[model samples]
Structure formats: C-alpha cells, structure tokens
Target: MRLENVSVRYHRRGPWVLRQADAEVGPGEVAVVLGRNGAGKSTLLQVTAGVLRPTRGRVVDRPRHVGWVPERFPADQPFTVAYYLTAMARVAGLSAAEADRAVDEWTSRLGIAGFRRVRLADLSKGTAQKVGLAQAMLRPPGLLVLDEPWEGLDAAARDLVPLVVDEVLAAGGRVLVSDHRNETVRLPGARRWTVAEGTVTETGPDEPEDVAVVEVAVPAARVAGTVARLRAAGHQVLRVRAAGRARDGATPGVGPRPPAADDTALPDEVAR
Candidate 1:
C-alpha cells in the first residue's frame, strides 16, 4: 500500500498533523513507526490503516480487508469477548460457523479463553488488549496496522507481538506498527519510519556493527522462550544450531553452548 503526499488536519484552518507524508509498505514486509508522544505517529497510522481520511493526497492500492488495532481499544462496549470477536469476524467476511470458530480459535490463541464469556467492559487493561489483538487476527487481512500494540500487555503478551508480525509476514501480508517503548527490537529487518513535526521519513536498518556473537546452550524445549527474552532485551541473536554439531549438520535435540568468557563482546545496544 502507498500514501502519496498525505496531509491531515482536524479543521480547515487548523495546523496539519501530517504533511506530505509519502510512505509505502508492501507484502511480506513490516514497517515500524517511531516518534515521541503527540508527534503524529497515531495520525500516520490512522491514515495508513484507512481509519481516517487525509485532507490532501490519497492512499492507493490498499487492501480490501484491513485489520486495524487502535492505540486505545473501546472496551466499554456491552458485548462479551466471544460475541464481539464473532461479530467482527462476520464483518471480516466470515460465515456464521466460521465466525464462531474464529472467535474460539483466536480467544484460545491469545490466552483469553477464560474471558470468552466475560463482558469487555469488565476485563483488565491487559486482558482487553488481548481481546483487541484477537479480534484483529480472527480474519487475517492483507494489511495489518497496529498502534502501540505492546501497551498494557503483560510480558508474555508482549512477546507474542513479534510472533504475530512473523505470522503476518509468513502469510505474505503487510504490517505497519507504531511504538515508543522500544519493545519492537524482536521484529528483525523491519523498515523504520520516523515521524517528527508532522513529517515522516524512512530509514533503512542500521549497518551491523563490529561485535562478538554469543551462543547460549538452552534446552530444546526452552529455546523459543530464551530467544524471545534475548531479542526483547535488545540482543541480536546470530543463529541457533544443534549442540556439538556443525552449522550444516543434522539438527539435535539440545541447543549449542555459549561462547567462552574470555571472548570479547559488545553490549546489546551496539548490536541492535
């Protein structure tokens, strides 16, 4: 999808929140929107998600099914989690049975199964965030737009953010997310869009710095969790290989060992 010379303002004579913001994100790619509070990050995301109309310019080639998760989910609704998700699924072009199945599937996947029958207004902030995420994924869209997806989520839920992005990319879908908490380090190879003073500019990933690579020996069952932790901590994991085996050797049940303590290593920030 592409936004050409996009500009937005609340009123005709009001100041523009975004000006001539030209940006594009294609299938199988993820773009991160970065900016300080009140810097038009949410406005850009709204425009990208087709939730808000731009005062000038236009969006082209946007997908028909666009999944948008706003910064603040409206949890004051009277519908239960299951009911709300099912209704949204239908809106996303699912049949009655399909919508029921989708609601069950996503509620389970997002760890909100117990709250399926609970009213949205009664759920906690984190649980409400989970519902927000689950609804967006009930029917995968060609373009997925998230605004501060990590906000109000627990640690485990926060870790799921990258996995969701991976799922979208694997399905050849495009993703555009805005974040200020630096919690998106796990989204490897994501293009960066920095917004400042109602202007947006794209920046490619930084060049890899000279740093030592460390390999930790974790049990096979624990590898996924360990990798997620490392990535969340701003560490760039080089690769994962079987223990005591060559890089191209057959996979083993156990993980590889860590580097010797004497090895020179740079801080995780440098690697990021």
Candidate 2:
C-alpha cells in the first residue's frame, strides 16, 4: 500500500498531527513505526490502515481485508468478548458458521477462551488487548496494522506476537506496527518509519550496529535447511562459503561433512 502526501489534523486550524507524509509497504513486508509517545505514529498507522482519511493526500491500494488493532481497545462497549468478536466476524463478511468457528479459533489461539463470556468492560487491560488482536485477525488480512500491540501483553503473549507476524508474512500479507516497549526486536528486518514534528520519514530497514558474524559448516545436503533455520531464528546469513575456504581463508575439510546434532555456530541472532 502507498500513502502519498498524507496529512492529518483534528480540527480545521488545529496543529497538524502529520503533514505531507509519504510512505509505502509492499506485500509480505513489515514496517515498524517508531517515535516518542504521542509523536503521531498512531496517526500514520491509521492512515496506512485506511482507518483515517488524510486531510490532504490519499492512501492507495489498501487491501480489502485490513485488520486494525488500536493502542487501546474500546472496552466501554456493552458486548461480551464472544459477542463482540462474533459481530465483528460477521461485519468482515463471514457467514454465521464461519463467524462462530473464527471466534473459537482466534480466542483459543490468543488464550482468551476463558474470557469468552465476560463483558468487554469486565476484562482486564491485557485480556482486552488479546480480544483486540483476536478481532482484527478474525480473518486473514492482507494488511495488519497494530498500534502498541505489546502494551498489555504478558510474557507468553509477548512472545506470540512475533509468531503471529510470521504467519501474516508467510501468507504474503503486510504488517505495520507501532511499539514503545522495545518489543520489536523479534521482528527482524522490518522497515522503520519515524514520526516526529508532524512529519513521517522512512529511515530504511532496521540495522543494529552491535553485531557479530559467524560461520557454520554443514553438509551440502543440509545447507538449505541450515540457512532456513537461521533465518527463521532472525539471523541473517551473510553468505554460504564453499568447503575449500573458511573465514580466515584456510581449508577446513576436503568436502562437505555431516553436521553434528548441535551444529549451530551462530553466536547471536540479529535483524536482516
């Protein structure tokens, strides 16, 4: 999707939250919005998700299925958790049977099954946040926008966030998220968008400075699997060297050898 010359303001003459912002995120890509609190990161995400119309420019090519989870869920609603999600599923065009199935599946996956019958207002902040995530993902979305998704999550839920992102990416969906708790370290290789002073700037992909590269030797037959495992763990594989040359230009073996059970040589996992 593309945000061309986007801008926003609450009132006709109020201070602009975002001004002349331009950005884009393609299929299967993830863009992490960054800034101090109230720096308009949410505004940019809203525009990207088509939840807010830009005061000036426009968002083009937004997907038909856009899953949006706000910073705080609207727990003031009278509906129960199950009722709200079921209603949202229907709104997303699912049939009665599909809605029920979806509600069950998502509530189970998000660990909110115990609160299914509880009213929205009765749930705690973390439980309500889980409901928010479940509703947005009632169906597979082409663009998933999450604003401060980690605000109320526990340790288990926090870890699940990256796995959820991985599923979306695997399905060729785009993900846009705003994080304040440094919880974005798990989303390796995501592009960064900084919102500040009523402006949005794309700072390119996230690349951490403190990093070390390690070499792993695997059999020719296991090379692909090893690389895939490394990448899934958020480690970038710089290159696949042949058997003749090691990192220090020394020969380690004559040909590829079988990898040991604990063959991994990666010291640390970093962003792509």
Best by lDDT: 2
Tens digits of per-residue lDDT, candidate 2, 1-272, equal 88889989989999999999988899889999989988999888888888888899999899899999999999999999999999999999999999999999989988999999899999999999999999989999999999999888876686678878988999999999998776776777799898889888886675656776555677788887887677556575655766654434445654345445698754355434
TM-score per candidate, chains pooled = 0.81, 0.78
Candidate 1, superposed: residue stretches over 4 Å from native: 207-233, 236-272
Instruction: Give the whole-model CA lDDT for all candidates, comma-separated.
Output: 0.84, 0.85
RMSD, every candidate, angstroms: 6.8, 8.8
List, residue by residue over 143-217, the lDDT tens digit for candidate 1. 889999999987678868888888888999999998877777767678899999999998776665566555467
- Count clashing pairs, candidate 1: 0
Top model number, TM-score: 1
